[model samples]
Target chain A: MKSNDISLPTVPFRTRGGVRVPHRKTTSTCESIVMTVPSQVSIPMQQHIGAPCKPTVKVGDIVCVGQVIGDSDQFVSAPIHATVSGKVLKIADIPMTNGAKCQAVVIASDGLQTPYSELKPPKTDTLDEFLSAVRASGLVGLGGAGFPTHVKLRVPKDKNVDTLVVNGAECEPYITTDHREFLENSENILYAIVKVKEMLNLKRVVIGIEKNKPDAIELMRNLIKKEGKSDYIAVLALKASYPQGGEKVLIEACTGRVVEMGKLPADAGCIVMNVTSLGKLAEYLKTGMPLVTKRLTIAGSAIKEPKNVIVPIGTMIKDVIEFCGGYSEEPKKILMGGPMMGIALTTDELFILKQNNAILAFNEKDARLMETTDCIRCGRCVASCPMGLMPPLISRAVKLNEIEELKSLGAMNCMECGCCSFSCPAGKYIVQTMRTAKAMIRSAK
Target chain B: MVGKLYASSSPHLRQGDTTRKIMLDVIIALLPACIASVVIFGYMSAVLIAVSVVSCVICEYICRRIMKRNNTIGDLSAVVTGILLALNYPVSLSPLIAIGGSVVAIVIVKQMFGGIGQNFVNPALTARIVLLTSFSSKMSNWTEPFAYLNKNAADAVSTATPLADGEHLTSYFDLFFGIHGGCLGETCVLAILLGGIYLVARRVITPLIPLTYMGTVAILSLCFGLDPIYQLLSGGLMLGAVFMATDYTTTPLSNLGRFVFAVGCGLLTMLIRQFGSLPEGVSFSIVIMNILVPYIEKFTRLKPKGFIKPKKESASK
Candidate 1:
């Protein structure tokens, strides 16, 4: 055969493997409507990932919106703010969506959202003031990972942080809260970007958005152009792939730099922030308000009127679902975030947390799993794993309790993205098996 | 909500491709080759295929029953193994011999090692090797195309395959169109190519192993001053490369590992064909490579992204 007939063009960037999950962003165009204030709110004291906060207010005390109801003395935690003016009813332990029980402060709303009179904009004259202001605003990663924003943004003095990656790649299915925030709160997001740039003296800022959201990409590009800082701030359109919004993946896509294992993005001279978290931070910086109300996308097969709603933090999922026309059918499963990485809620009575961006409820037809069979060793799980770890081998290691083999396979690097399980033809719970293996490794260590 | 809600882990969605669907695709891809075999070798080919398929299924069902395992014959994997085993044998082989091969494949090679996806080697190839060693003279009897359909002829005589001796060469067109004497599935280049193309299109198997294996063989054959096209079209290279060597459980996981495995199979096949006493080497080469699959996978395991390999020694020292 002739050489010309046999030569094939090679695909570029072939190592970056990820599955293309469906973008069920039904509420992307729906304007967010403020939810009706609930008669009672049970704000959990442990919403963020670090130290859980303690209740600062006792029962029978009156609290107002923007009032600090719970605070933590630990350096890694964020304080909780009341979303409505109400009488503290009780302080009791409540079950969280992940099946953990945490102390929650319940308050009966008085129908008046009384703003705290002590609210005032902080001084932004210095870097310390800006950092303290971000911490006081009680902002964490609103993109599902509840890592405290102040802790993430604090670059060590020994390291030089030069880039700020504003993650707009909402790669999850059925979640469009970030897209809506980009469209509706564009100004605040831009303000936050500018403030962050000024505060950190960053050289470059990249806003990475998936290609599925053309309007959001266009809007962000236009905003950057209007600011006349196109050279410093650029909007990059990436391929629409699941887990493209992951911190390490985004860092690689935007900067062509890899965040080494067990290292933060700062180690690669980059600090990543979610789009919605930045918007909330900007709003707080200007209005002197903390993170109380959150914009969420209520969607999935069980939801009758799937739309975007802004509800106060700690609003019961039952009340939120009722606000969106209630369940059309019996919900077989309720998730607290996007379908891929969302936490399944055991009860609808579980309260929404600060990191919840979407609440998905699926009927029996959509939620039922297939009968699992023996793995045919098709290698689809290996191909679809974004982390490049072999889940089948990891699962085998777990079955045999081979800790050394598990470590060699890089089981600790699994972020539990669910791509392996989703792409498996045998319907194997690949991610769950990896999770078990990871736990075993941890215990062994 | 009206009833108890179901709560499990994340990833509530699936790609919806089942193992049965994948096996069905493989069977569909093999159809054109089956038709070609029947057309060239006459009704005897059809009879052999039928006997092999039925016996393999029965054997698998009986074995699974004895083992108290769920019946997996529904996945169509047993049918695939039967067809592959039948296609690898000459049409002149007796029905009893074909059934024996099916029993060895399904009962001993497949079930004894656990069913589909658990066997360390391709069941059909193993049975082919076993039959070749046990009944060499009977297994080597090749018949000319359309001879069995000739009613006026007294008897069709056994003929030598193209690979048996260079003097038994036929026209390139006859060889390419599968009118020459050979195994049922290995004769027709056109039929096997069509089936391989269908497989690649449906993505039931990646083209990596087949392409690399065939490419290595062709290059090595050219270097040895042999007619590359003849070496490729003769023997069981096409069938083994396309079907046998790509068996999922017997192959490596990573693409890099697959490349290494295919290259190793190609090298071994060329060495055996050129130096060993046997005229054909595809089955032996693939079985050997299948035995090395776990090692290949271990060495070629993909390094996780952002993983830095620790240097063994300092360069300065």
Candidate 2:
């Protein structure tokens, strides 16, 4: 009998587990075209993760572009800026995509984008000055988390952060805004890396990009080489996997250091920033413009002309869909981001927030979910969970209201990456059940 | 803006796999064994398979109706159980015994425990055990291949299985090609290999359980100064390792759990066959291991990545 010759790798880097999501980056090569200014824009007071901002401009007040229309004294919140020169029409409550109502300043565009008179670059010779400028620029994590950038960059005194990790993976399916940013804004990103390294006195900076985006990786490597900072700045090509762009996963993938549970990236000696966030920071340093406009990818099954566009922050989703050549069919689902971790919009009236990197519209065929069946205990969910948690066991515990079991299963560590739900052959809502489990665990505590 | 939009949680996309597709793959993988059974046991094998499959489906439908639960026969899990039950029986067994086994498998073993994935043990294996204990004489009555074509042949001949001690050893080629008397599915080594390969390729069953189970059995047989090849080819080892032991509901959820479960199954089978009164031990070994799945899973639970176990304080005087 002839034995089959099958050789396996001796040492596999299986530190993180994630599924290979389809990279339907249709607009990767599409140059970002400026979207037509809407007749009116509605800027929500709350865009970041912390306390909601209070409206500073009342109804009928004239506001210029780059002017802060809303501000919050909270340390973890970012101010809201006007994306167009307009007259505030109303300060009514608007429904957010997450089903929360927040105060929004609705403004009528005057067709004249007047720049704010206070727009000027600030002197940043010290770290405090640099942090203040970032805060004044109204920058948040543009990778879709919407975390206040200044709060994230301010490492606590107890922990040391020596390495700066730039997240360029863009691993989600059907979103290529970051890839485009790397290709078009490589210089600005490199400049921001240099500035951040000097400001924080960091020793190394690593940019993690998935191997699927070869062009982005090559461009970043060449830029780092050209800048003569190859020793300080290295581009690491990661295996294409969903949620590789996650802060914890990216930190581990680039540095081989684990961010302990319930601990920040600073605990691992790393501060991770999104690629577009860094580029926007560099742009703000040079142009002194607040984060008022966003570059996003608009593509899905329902879209007629899926492409990349640079639109104002307060643009309604309906206007953006129209800019992409209106839906080819009735849009059955509208999502604020990529398919894996995006929030489904109940109504198209929601405005594009600062952190939204993609707006997807799916027709009936792509939107309809498969009928959920019984979990066959196939172990696929366990094998694919990036956190290494057992989704099936946690889901069962949730159904039975077993709080102790849920806690022991590490339900709180779940980042809700949707890998378990996506890989389930039975179409089980594994992530939904895990969310319920996490919520139950929290309440029990 | 156009119509009522469906709103749900995150993960708007699916990997396009369904229960029906997975069940269909299992059925496809079992075809080669089905064909081989019919070839070895003559026309009676086909009738038994059809009867078992129909009876199992009907029993599942009736059970669901009585329980007021949604019908799950469309998933074809009941059909797989039915085919597996029939394949485990001797061709000379009466049609009533086959239907009885199917009912036991679908209703008593499966649906009564809250249907497909909720069943604790492999339904087909449980049904085979029930039939074996209740109707031992009829279940053991074996017939020669093509005996139906001979008018003078008896209905059944009390023939010893290949696993029986003191029986003349069959040629390796005949054993591999399934020319001797045994259970329908366990006869052909070639056919079982083809089906096992298909299941592994379709990813319906990972090779962890099957490989570890067979490897342990082969090594133990050699250690006991028995024929390793005979031990692997005879009895229901191939069918149980490939089909029954790999049943999704009964097996553990982690690969480490499965590896331990497979090793336990192999060790128990060796102990039962060598010392116990039963000439065969595949079904017994699997049933015992199935009962220990929870403990196996608990002991072998994977420590999540980046999880740090806190230090424990020693007990002081």
Candidate 3:
């Protein structure tokens, strides 16, 4: 499917073994509209996958937009920025969807999203300076993993990091935040690719987008050509498959490099970054604004009017849903991301975190559990797994309580992409079995 | 915040395929043969199928009730077994004797172990073997085709099957068209191939097992200095290789394991047919291969992709 419509060469790259999922990219063409500022936002201190930050502002302290209200001394942590310019309402422990409580800075908004002016774009003349700028900007992977981008962007001196892969392969169905980013913020994406490529001293930058969205792929290829860095930056059209955007899977699809088990992507001589995270980094460099707002795709069966909303971080999910014409019906289930790999929310009372890219709500019919039956030994799960791990055999190992067999079957290698369970004819929850198997192996150790 | 929202792990979405749906797909795939059986072997073949199917379903329900387990008849696996068992029977078999085969298939071979996917060996194939030993004369009493075409065709002649010898074997065209003395469904090569294609198209069964099994049998027939076309078009091999040998419960789960199992089945079937005293070997060969599924799977477990290299391999790279 080469596009000779323009002078640019369209890149078609794909890897094997991921299940095909529907792409509900209706919001891909919808330009993001800024949401009305909520009266309050409770910014959680532990948005990233690292040490939790401590709240610096107590109750009744005055705070504004882009103010660092929470900071941690740990190297892996990013500071939590105030998304709204308002008064510090309270510093309280908020319950999270994971059943743990986290410290949050609760701020009551003044209805105006005033800028936090104390910050300025730091120096990026060297590798150390660039990473420090990333950390200062409160940047983390806006993808669902919520990994701190500064740490991911940091490469060791001896690792020989060469290529930089930008993750535009939004493989999850019904989540089009990354797709919208490519369409709306193409210039910012190109700007970050050139800057990161120069700063990291990388050989080339390959932006991987799923082939389902030809518009985004074409735009990226043309944008790179227009920037006059066609040799340094290229675009890759990836096959549309569930979990194709996963770090290890994308790495294999891009360069045919295998990231070793229990090792970092840096070990494979690659650095992967999220598509939206790149745009935000470029925005931060120009405007001196930390990451306070997020682009979220709000759609599902239960949602009334779906849209691509640029809601501020820490806005309550209920308020966001209400802005999109509220629930079409009483929602039975609300997911924090796409239906495949999203975390189910106990309540809509939780505020949006930095890593959440979509909020999917489902009605009773769409959310009900399936009636399970015996596995017919169909081998569909084995064929569907991108990792090529045998799930049913691992399930049997878990049943027999064979810990060594579980370990040998590589139970720890499962990314829980939900491919096996999705393809199972018997409606068996194979991923749950893998999770339980992993837990059993861990406890036995 | 409005209601008691249910929360679980990731993957709230499902592909919505169920056990009943898969069994229904199998029944649909086997429809072409079911119709062909009644047409070729006359109305008695339909009677045999009716008795076998009713007997098996009732036996499954009663067995599950007696064992204090949930009934599995809803999945239609019992119906599938019943039809397969009926297709393996000759039209001359007594109705009471047909019920015995159904009992042996549903109760003894299937529900005794566990229902549906829990059976270790193929229930219908095993039951056909059991009946072959218990009442050999009735089980092998092959009936002539097209008895219903004549108004005064008295109790259609019982004759020697094509498997017997060169004397009874029909022409190649008649054998392929199933106009000869044989069991209800196994005589019609065209009907069975249509059903096999349907199953493969529906993604219910892969073409690997059928291709490997039939390909092995064809090559081995040539090696035995026999007419390969006659060997393939003869009794039961097409039906057994397509529907019976590919039973999910009795077969291996991995692709590699299935390949080895199908090849092994072809080897055993050819050996038994060429060397042994029995005229037919498909049922016995499948049962033998079914018993070896676990061992085949053990040797062919899938290796994880992009696995870590050992220290020695890392140094070599």
Candidate 4:
């Protein structure tokens, strides 16, 4: 039995522990503006988690929009697509914010977002055909963790999935991309849910939306009922909490089935899909276009004209920031996602990937490093940890370079939610230490 | 942007909190008690508190400089310790005793054990016990309330405390209003309750330890065929439960472990007051429980929610 001591009073179902993050969903009502295509895009070969795609196009190669520019033979990887009709400027190694030098195809746009000639909706009379169609779509989990979408959807032969949990809990502070998706693309989202439910032979579907977005929840509920899928699909209003949309936390809240350690959602008899990922799938089925344009919330304290904007994949962050009225102040930190789980980029020159849902530029006041103090053992971190990880213990293990202690403390289970660090009165960088301990554990192994 | 952009791991945003901020909250919470002590016990108690705080801060500053540690007087933990140490002393004691306890607390107990969050026991409580041992006569010279109200300037009438060896217990009204003889801050139950509420409101301390500490004591006193309310409002139980036992560095971090630590404190305190030679055992029980915190946390470690039963490698950890 779990205690929901930290849950809000209005919450119907609750998970164990999560921090109360401010919902800075400022751009939820704004129309997602279609930005002007940049002169060029630097599409990296490795957009999502898996094997890095080998570049299929070289410098001076003419490529049309939606054409496969990079692909991997590995089953786990997704193909990279050209977002603009252009000539490839260069295919070379480039350093990324994630600290990896990967092959990138720099395309010089010809000012035309022309679709590929072979673009047509593929046949999907069966599950395998549907999965194959999805595999070629260059889609991944767009909810921050860029796990391949098709791989997540491919329920194994031995297991049977009963529920499809759509993650609509955009619980992060500044990111409202999913909220806008439910508002702007309701019809397609329903289509995807019903289609996936039928294809997977799932009994029910639960779309978990945070109560912060009452408009989206009401809109989704109205759509699900108007389509007469209420019996099969339920719109759950979740309490607004940080990491409420976390895979395991959402699964448990929606389906009451825990996604235990070392197990996928498939193991727990559910297929969890991000709301945008589902919308993208339905869009691909309609227009036969692969994932090229991504709509994301461009927001933060440093952003001048913060709003949701749709830009082609691989558009340089610098161009997008410039498109969004540039910085209000000298940017001290630029992130590729929300503040909690976002990747901090040293430069604004990095290309936006398929999974990127937010581009936040923070000034020195918000991005400055905290001065660390000794652990007071206030237990705020312990109580705030969504995974029940003892960050202080992990931090202690890291300081002592104790590999075995790190393993026993389950430092690997830390999802880097930043809940502990956010709540720390001492401002101890416990999550950073856990990341260090994870690296140490891996090396020791 | 001209300046080089800073980059680090995820969760770039942090809440507005500093060690100084938290310590300041604690100091704010203790203000009621500090003022109440001065009001009830008179100008001497205020002087004692001032002496302890000043000396504790100076001792910490000098010791850190001598040991070449980073200057940590800015954290205000020494200030908190000084206040707590003075609050535990009888108002009639000399100001020199406060200075000596400051040395014992800041120099010996706190800094010697690596300062601040590194100490294994509550520094103020340890200093109190050492003072009680070294200056037994000075420590026990409890001054009655309204001692300064006597128009004639004379030495204070040293009286028996409520917890002193006697069949006559002070009235419940006197105990609650702090009209009886006891430590400066420990007598005023109302003021201490207000301070506890403030700490809880500020989120500087959780209610788990304090609730369990007093609750267990009340229940156990009832079991011992004694008046639970009389047992509660009298002595340093309320003060100890609220502030000393809930010290962040010395107690267990897990919720369940805190429950055990508080229950242990309640039980030991009751047993000592009933059977042992000491009249009060709050400090002793806390120090004993503080020593067992590492062991308590080991057994009562919060099992990660991912944990599954039927462990294959049971003996390894």
Candidate 5:
């Protein structure tokens, strides 16, 4: 499966209510910064949010850069690969993002990354072969969900997908690696989109981007226009909204079709893929390399210098921090994703994964939580929530541990967009409580 | 540069809105009514408003500082409470009572209960009730609006307000245009309407509560031949429908909740007006309905999707 220049259609979609988040894009999105493989790479088996992948290779086993070290039997889990041709030093539990230890494969890099088996084009050109190839390569969604890509590509027979939506929205604040990747590797991504289309046997493909990033929109538009393929492949410029990058919201905004809650986009006759994922797919198809590296945004107010670093998957957070000139001061908190939805990592020993999009090193000021006071009943939360859920009322129920009230109030439907919390004047933790409420409701069920 | 990143609760964005801004908007929305009161009731309206606003501000400042709390009277909520309380009183009421009402609203009702958004009851309504019960004579003293005007005199005639226009209800034009005299705010229909329009346009408050409340009352009164126009233009109905009934702190949370609250306020207002001892019933009705807000919200809760669906079972299970 070499990179074939095949014609494919790009579907354009809209985005919901976006806040004007400070870009910090110039520091990271302007150029690609590739970090050298660390001397000792601590590769975690279960970096993404899913069932932990079991280690296939043990401690003291010599492994090459592309060799799979961790593979899971579960369909939802992903495998971990060695980043450098190296000797495995340890296979033990280490700190992860969720405040618990997970098994990791630690290797001492030999400074030579020659693969044990040289990567070549896929031997077969069938859909099954492509699926097997994708499974072998260990690629996930890469836009942060980290769902096994092979699983997503396997469309259910009941739902017929007419278009493949490539989400280039990159709508999250302080993250611009996807924008940079699209500008640098538009052709590669296009090839990946075509391959996806071929696999799905779909005729149309679309790329949705927010209008704020005019450069990305203009670049993609010009690239498609220059190829004289505007009809088949087009760029859609969506109005800016936070969480507009979410799969369901993006589907609704772009296609004007509401994918009912608890249903996939396929239920709405659509499949969404992030631009970075498609770019990696293109690379995998062309070079037959396993998913070993990813583009991550290293940003926040505390970092000395913020930039997008192309680091091998499983690289330690500490190493990445050093590569970014270390923290301006000891960061008050380290976050694994964007501010609105990111998980707070207690320790910086967490490893980067395909799903890890950004590492935010925020100082005390950035991590300051508003002291929740009495609910002012401003109804601002009601007005600002894109999902149309009343956050303050739901939060009240959650704080009182009223699960039934939460369920009735549609607490389960909250996308955790943080719009309610963002707009609140009483400083109540609306989203946090809603998250807890959602968890309680799900567990009760 | 090493900058201190502000760590707040979950939501970091404030939308640049503050209690002060909302209170300021409330005060601004009340401007037309204040001006109308001054024009119709002469210098008495101006003095009462000034005395009430100043007393409330001073009392709020003292209470907040004495409690070692953030002095949020700067937010102008005290000013709003002050103005609303004063507007509820008669133009003939001594400036001392207006100031006293301001103190009661700002100190006893608002600040004592935790300031701004913390009060369980509408501060203005609480103060008005307190004053009415405490000084019935002052509260109910309805005057000729401008010191017993004689028809032969050159000065403008300030007839007893619509409710007090003897047996016949005042003309629709006189009521709509604010010719009759009542309390500082209740006297002017045009002023209240203009303020409501401004509030709606600025998104300070939704039209649901005001429109629904007024619409329900007008429809019911009209059906009973109670003169919808005069009913709308009379007493505290316009002011209460536009302002006090829409108090964010005491009202329901959802659009549906607000609608229900408005409807309830309307029905209660009409029932009390037609049957109760009082000529007007807006104040008592709002207070009564405020008690049902939590229950109203509960009954009107929005059911989120997939809330009722059972989780999918694994193939192994």
Candidate 6:
């Protein structure tokens, strides 16, 4: 066996366990950006992980650019705004993957460039003023986890936060929109990071980029020198690893602190935000434009032309595909995010929400649906698991219906990072079984 | 490309290891033992092994089909069970008796409880014990190496295995090379070594179970004034340590658990051999340890994150 290609020098910064996934990045990484516009947009009222925003406008109401369509009921949620000047078609429920439907605001674009609200850049701003501007503009993390940026900036009183980590580790296989965003909007990203750090009353800030994307690193380095702010901020080269971009892992990699299990990153005196989220924040702070548009990567073998596109928040994925010259072949799987943590959509009717970063359309040839077999108890899953829990054992406990055994094996501790399932040779849906066990234990508790 | 699309949870990637692949690896590791059994115990040993494997597969198939579950006999785990049972039996055992052991292993011990990992005890060991109790004379019919008139032997002369001497010394090489015989696959030390080495190389069985188990047996036997080498080489020590006790599902979770399990297996095997009614106790010892796996995992519950340090305030207290 070849040992040279397998060893890692920075194990602590990354993880010891990750499968060698086939890289489909070459498909779209070189492609230039292509903007896509849809005839109609159906933006979901709730795209983030928190509470859904309530609709502010009912059916037949005309909504212009930057006009709030759905108002947030909670501070954690981001308000939805119209990407185009349009008349509301309906505010109805659309099917989601969770098997339930969520209310979405549907609008037909009027093909007119209409601006409802605008503001000039402030000459001098305080942290409180900037935060208020961010919250009022309805900016949220555009990097899949639509965490409200302002809320994330609100550091707890008990702990002192000194570092703000920018998550540019787009470790997922196909999605390179983050990689592209870093390359294209380096100034904005750096500015956003500085803005967030200032808001948190922190001086130390680091942009952590996976070594795989050296270009993004180079861009940040050049911009850092050009901006002459290299002392306060630096680019940390994180070893390329799956789930390296996970908040906990990123915290450990950047600041060398383990976010204790069952505790938030904020508990460890750190906050990590995605690079695109920073760019959106920068856009909001500068132009006073509400977050009504997002950058999405349209790639995979099914797409005739693979490229990154800045699309409206509610643009249909099918429209984006058509804008990219339409599909050459039917897709075996159409994922809304990256392959590792992305959700596969059964219908294109599932509009691209604010949280969506990539729309992957892989043909049948791209998918390798492995045949599942009974677990041979190899204990590889146990060894390779990042959370240090035994997946194979817990999965066995589940198979035997031994709930007590499952709990004892720490099934609940599973992060569902998919590392166990990804590395399992038995093709035993070990991750799914672990998730099932965790669910059972949770429900029982 | 156009199959029925289904939405499932994350971790779309799966490990290639399967129960069938694991069982096949075990069978491959048991190859040296099989060869030794055939060489020492004659064609009857080979015939018995074939009978066991076939019977076990058939039984597993029947059980699964009857229960309306997907047939998993193709996984070859039942074959491992069959082979392990056959290795525990004497060469002179009839095909029907071997089949009975296989049936017990697959139908009663394996499928009846839920197949593969769900079995409470090591199925093959349990089956072997059942066979020993049910067919005492046949189970104990030891065949010495080169005893039977066979094509491989230059001279034909019937003899008893070195263990049958009641208490005697034999050359270490003969025992290690498996010149003496007791059971079919248990006759040759050379074959077991080859299989064990293969399994180790493939990483199918960790060294903790076999090494610790054998070490425990050696230490215990030495304390009791028995020849440590003889105790380690005699009967089913190699076969049991390598194949039966290292069973994935029946064993505990961690290395610590495995070490404890192995030590327990070894101690029990030596105790049974020295004081109990059974002259060889590998199967019985492993079955006993299988029952303790759950408790072992419980006691060794990973120490969590804070339970170890108690946040430094406990240090002050």
Q: Could you give the interface RMSD of candidate 1 in angstroms?
A: 1.6
Q: State which candidate, 2 or 3, has the greater lDDT.
A: 2
Interface quality of candidate 6 as DockQ: 0.26
Displacement of residue A187 (Cα, Å) in model 3 is: 0.9
The local distance difference test score of each candidate is 0.88, 0.87, 0.86, 0.87, 0.77, 0.75
TM-score, cand. 5 vs. native: 0.83
Better of 5 and 6 by lDDT: 5
Which candidate tops TM-score? 4
| Candidate 3 chain A lDDT trough over 10 residues, lowest sum | A1-10
What clash pairs does model 1 have?
none
Clashing pairs in 3: none
Off by over 4 Å in 3: A1-14, B151-153, B308-317
Stretches off by above 4 angstroms in model 4 are A1-12, B309-317
Residue range A160-197, candidate 1, lDDT tens digits: 77888899999999999999999999999999999998
* lDDT by residue (tens digit), candidate 2, A316-408: 999999998999999999899999999988888889999999999999999998898788887889988889898878888987998877777
DockQ per candidate: 0.63, 0.69, 0.66, 0.66, 0.31, 0.26
lDDT of 4 by residue, B1-317 (tens): 43688887767878788889989988888888888888898998889999999999999999999999899999999999999999999998889888999999999999998988899999999999999999998898888788889877566688888888467568889888788888998989988989999999988888999999999999999999878898898899999999999999999888999999999999999999888898889999999999999999998887776655423345757
Candidate 6 versus truth, CA RMSD in Å, comes to: 5.9
lDDT of 2 by residue, B12-130 (tens): 98888888888999899889999998998887898999999999999999999999998899999988998899899999889998999998899898988889788898899999999
Query: What CAPRI class is candidate 1?
Result: medium
Q: Which portions of model 2 show Cα errors greater than 4 Å?
A: A1-13, B145-152, B155-158, B308-317
* Candidate 6 chain B weakest lDDT stretch, 10 residues: B304-313
Give the alpha carbon lDDT tens digit for every residue of A1-445 in model 6.
0011211123335443455555567643554454645779888887776889899998999889888888766768777788878899998998775557899988998877487755455432776787777776676776677778778776668866666778898777778888888877888888887777776777577678888898888889889889987877778887777777877667767766666666667766667888988887787777778788777888877889888888888887778888888877877777788777777777665687777888877777655577776665656666566566777667657778887666556566666677777766567666678778988877765
- Candidate 3 lDDT over A10-116, as tens digits, reads 44444546787777777777788899999999999999999999998888987878889999999889998999998999988888868799989999999988887
**Highest DockQ, which number?**
2
